[model samples]
Target: MSQSPAPARRRRGNARGEQTRSVLLAAAVRAFADRGFHGTSTRDIALAADMSPAVMYAHYATKEDLLFELSLDGHRSVQVLLDAEVGRHASNTDRLRAAASCFGQWHAEFHTQARVVQYELNALTAEHLAEVTVLRRAIQGLFGDLIRAGVDEGVFQVADAEMTAMSLTSLGIDVARWYRPTGAWTPEQIGHHHGRLALRAVGVAD
Candidate 1:
């Protein structure tokens, strides 16, 4: 299947209201990424969104609520992307290449949101964390399945499919930590680079 652009998070009904919610979410992503969730206040997010705290509250009941939505969207975006990519290719190597490339590129393109999603798990309510963990596990499962398929094909020599899958995921997710638009590589370039690296990581020559 062809990929769809990541959908904007929707809530509270109506186009205008949804627009406001999206704006607030973007602001919250910036704040949480810049100042760590515990260090940033709702007022900071509201101000960043050019709204009063009360208006921000109207959209999100709590700061953690905003984080939950962001985290949920971020994880869901990755899962949907990986699912589509995994389905598009028949061979295990092709699946791994597409998954690793898109995963790395996503982190680079949406670094701020990715940063919050990757690092703010501790700040989410336990209930919210559980929900996000489900998505995380589904994503990890895709990588594990791909690695196992490669091993079964005699194309990958990993001793532990699960551990190799996690390491591959870590390589992609870590892109959000240090990526800069000013850097030499574009997201697509970095993504393909990661794709080649992933092939090697799985014991396939690029």
Candidate 2:
């Protein structure tokens, strides 16, 4: 009788596959960050991954697939981080402080991926764009919730919670565009500063 493959062998194959996909993703983020999505090609990503075009194709059917994956992962990761950060504090002031710091520092730490996530949405197919949009909206909603909470508690004075939320998010997202490790401020410093600024922006004394 024929038998199925060993569990260990299948596990090894799965691990290898995941590893390859990770390498490809790193390479893609770098490429897309340096060269916008339209300017990038599968061959470029394959070379950056140090793998052949065929291997890259085996993992990602199209360049858009890689981008969609990156965007989805980036947005989801940010949302989760913000959620955890905000949940850690009892007060809206503390929650905004943590959330802004986390958001800003994350962009500096993963600026390449952040850049692609923020700047490459136009290149995605409509179906992919719609999917990515849902994740983006969820992230925005997190910030909106925090701003609204602050307003409700009389901790934050803002004209419009929704617009204030968008502005707050933009402050962190823009960091990815120009953040450099060699800069005077480290990621932590930037984060701390952003935390203070966020409070001040929300009309809190900080």
Candidate 3:
């Protein structure tokens, strides 16, 4: 059966509202990434989006509310991207490699929003934190399951599949912290390298 949407997913009620909401989200990403969630205010977000407080409040209830929305959307995105990439391969190692690569690529490409999602969890309300954790765990489980499958098949030598999965997941999320578009490595290169590193981390030999 299909699951229902969360309250966070029910905000945009019409085409125009959705467009306004999108604008706010984009502005929030930049503001949060540059100044951080705690440092940026609703006014900062509204000014960046070129909207008044009344207009911004009409779209998002508060600063924390905007952060929650971004967190929810970003957390869901990693799972979707990871699952899609992992699903393309039959072997467990292959799946892990793809997941790691795609995870890295996404972190690099969407580093601003990703940085906010990864590094700003403390700013979210307790209720919002719990909501985002569901998606976060699901993404972690996808990678962990692949590691466990490889271990079962004697294809990996990890002492703990879940712990190893956590390490690999961090490998991707950390990229957004220091990665720059003008840097020597491109997102795809980072993605490919991360994939190989993940495979090696699990004892995939040459």
Best by TM-score: 1
Model 3, residue 183: distance off in Å is: 0.3
Candidate 3 — what's its lDDT? 0.86
User: Considering TM-score, which of the candidate structures 1 and 3 is the better prediction for this target?
Assistant: 1
Please give the TM-score that candidate 2 achieves against the real structure: 0.91
> Which ten residues in a row are the worst by lDDT in model 3?
1-10
**What is the Å distance of residue 98 in model 2 from its true position?**
0.8
- Candidate 3 lDDT over residue span 1-206, tens digit each: 01111224756388898889888988998999889888898999999999998999987789998889888888777776676678789988888888889888888888888899899999989998998888888888888988999999999998999999999999899999999999999989999999999999999962
Counted clashes in each candidate structure: 0, 0, 0
- What lDDT score goes with residue 142 in model 3? 86
Deviation of model 3 at 126, angstroms: 0.4
Regions more than 4 Å wrong, model 3: 1-12
Ranked by TM-score from best down, the candidates are 1, 3, 2
Residue pairs clashing in model 3 are: none
TM-score of each: 0.94, 0.91, 0.94
| lDDT, candidate 2, 1-206, per-residue tens | 11111111111357789889888988998999888998999999999999999999888899998998888888777877788788889989999999889888888887788889898899999998998899778877888898898899888999988888888889999999999889898888888888998898899986
Ranking according to lDDT, highest score first: 1, 3, 2
